[model samples]
Each structure stands twice: as C-alpha cells, then as structure tokens.
Target: MTEPLVVEFEVDAPRGHAFDTWTARCGLWWPKSHTVSGDPAAITFQPRPGGRIFERAADGTEHDWGEVLDWEPPGRLRYLWHLFFDRSEATEVEITFTEQGGRTLVRIEQTGWDRLGEAGPPRRDKTRQAWTAIGEQFRRACQ
Candidate 1:
C-alpha cells in the first residue's frame, strides 16, 4: 500500500466558519483548473454521509467528484475521492479542523493509492502538489 498524502495548514477563522468555507463555499476558492470540466460554474458539497461532492458546469451539467463517507461539522469530514471521474479508482480523503488560539488548523489526508494500480505513485505525487495549491486557496478563503 502506498503512503497517504497529508497536507496541513492554519486558517484565520474559527473552526465552524472554516469548515463552512471549506464545504459550502468551495466553488469560490477551488481552482477552476482543478475541475473536471475546467469551467465549472459552481462546486457544491452535500454535507452528509452518502451525499455528493460535485461540480456544476455553466450548461447545468453536474460532474461527480466523490461521495461523503462521514460528516462532522466544525471538526471532521471523510469522503471517497474520485476526482479522476472513476469510482473504481477512487481513494479516501479525510479532513479535520481543529481550533487553536484564534486560528483553525486544517489537515487533509488522502489514501488508497494502491487502487490506482501502476499509476499510483505518479498520480499521488501530482495530487500532493495539487493539494498544496488547493490548501493555500482554502487558507486564503478562510481569512
């Protein structure tokens, strides 16, 4: 099994607000280049177990990015990530929010790269870089 990719950062917001920004306002912060359509009109997260994380294009087409496995507001969220658009090749992602002083510490960990078969390592590396960029965007959004 390949090691999980973990990214951690601090945001200048309370835990609840940070969590809301991450889940409910993702479209405002998520990079358009990261979307499957490359031109998504909006990104939406259904904040419950078995709910969806998806992107909607200008034409109103929705693309599935993953399914929620767990949801705990202001604290944690876990989901199956299928950003490659293939559920069979999906991995698991867990994000946690912790309040410290006057800031929120956010941590994201993605695992199950072995499911990607021969492409696992390279894809994982690419995703790590992408997540770094994404994390910065999230942090800025929370500020």
Candidate 2:
C-alpha cells in the first residue's frame, strides 16, 4: 500500500466559516470535473455519522459517493469515500480544520488505496492532484 494522500492549505475564512463552506455550500464550489456525474445538480453530505455523501442530478437521479464516519463541526470530518469506485473499494478520508491567525488551515488525509490492487497508486496520484486544485477552489469559495 502507498502512503496516505495528504493535502493541506489555508482558507481566508475562520474555522467555522471554512467548515461551513466545505459542507453546507459545497454545491457552489465543487467543480464539475471532480464529480461522479460531472454535473450533478447538487452534492451533499448528510451531516452525521452513517449519513450519506452523495450527488443528485437535475433529473433527480442520485448516486452515493460515500458515508459519514465521523462529524465534528468546525474541527474534523472522517468518512468512507468511493466516488467512482464500488463501495467494496472505499477509502477513508479525514479532514481537519484548524484556526490560524483568523484564517483556517484545512488538511485532508486519505488512505486505503491498497483495496484497488494495481489501480491504487495511480488513483491516489490522481486524487492528490484533484485535491490540490480543489484546495484553491475551496479557499476562494470560503472567502
């Protein structure tokens, strides 16, 4: 297995603001290229343990991407993620939000690529790139 994919960046907003942007306002910042449907009408996290993380299309079609494992507003969120994969190949992702001089530092740690067998490393690399770009997108939205 490869090391967990880690990505960190700062948001101009405070911790709670940043966290809210990431969760409540996700449909506004999330890029279509990063979504399972590419153009989901809405993407949402159900906000509690065992809750669903999913996408809904304009046609009302829904597809689940993950499940919430832990939820701590303005502090941390841990979930099982399987965006374009089967649930059997789900990975774990934990994101933390920390306040820094009025700003928020967001960190994402994702692991469990080993389940994908030969496709693991490359998928992990792709997600790393996606997260890096998303960090910037997320920051702008938080402001």
lDDT of 2 at 29: 90
| Candidate 1, 1-143: lDDT as tens digits | 78999989999999999999999999889999889889898898898999999999999999999999999998999999998558998999999999999899999999999988889899999999999999999999988
Q: In model 2, what are the clashing residue pairs, if there are any? A: none
Against the correct fold, how does model 1 do in TM-score?
Answer: 0.96
Model 1, global lDDT: 0.92
TM-score of model 2 (CA atoms): 0.96
Listed per candidate, the RMSD to the true structure in angstroms reads: 0.9, 1.0
Candidate 2 on 79-111: residue-level lDDT in tens? Answer: 999988899999999999999999999999999
lDDT of 2 at 58: 84
Give the 10-residue window scoring lowest on summed lDDT in candidate 1: 82-91
